[model samples]
Target: MRRIRRSIGEYINLYNGKRPHSSLADQTPDEAHFGTVRAINSGA
Candidate 1:
């Protein structure tokens, strides 16, 4: 059960943090949600 939970958590993280979504202009969910903050922090 613990391993299963960890696997699910990892997959969720990947889906949100790494996988790009076409509906979101090919940005990952995290990128789509925090793009401006990221750009500002990076001095873009």
Candidate 2:
């Protein structure tokens, strides 16, 4: 239960408000999800 709660918190931060994902070009996951992706060495 505790582990699950901790994972949920981590996910919320990583995918909703924190964690500058490289796929997002250093933007938060929420930004990427909302089409706010920036241009970086994405290999795209």
Which candidate number has the best lDDT? 1
lDDT of 1: 0.95
- Give candidate 1 regions above 4 Å deviation: 36-44
lDDT of 1 by residue, 1-44 (tens): 99999999999999999999999999999998898798889999
Backbone atom clashes (below 3 Å) for every candidate: 0, 0
CA lDDT scores, all candidates in order: 0.95, 0.74
RMSD in order of candidates: 2.4, 7.1
Q: For model 2, what is the C-alpha lDDT against the true structure? A: 0.74
For 3-31, candidate 2 gives per-residue lDDT tens digits of 99999999887777777878768988777
lDDT of model 1 at position 6: 100
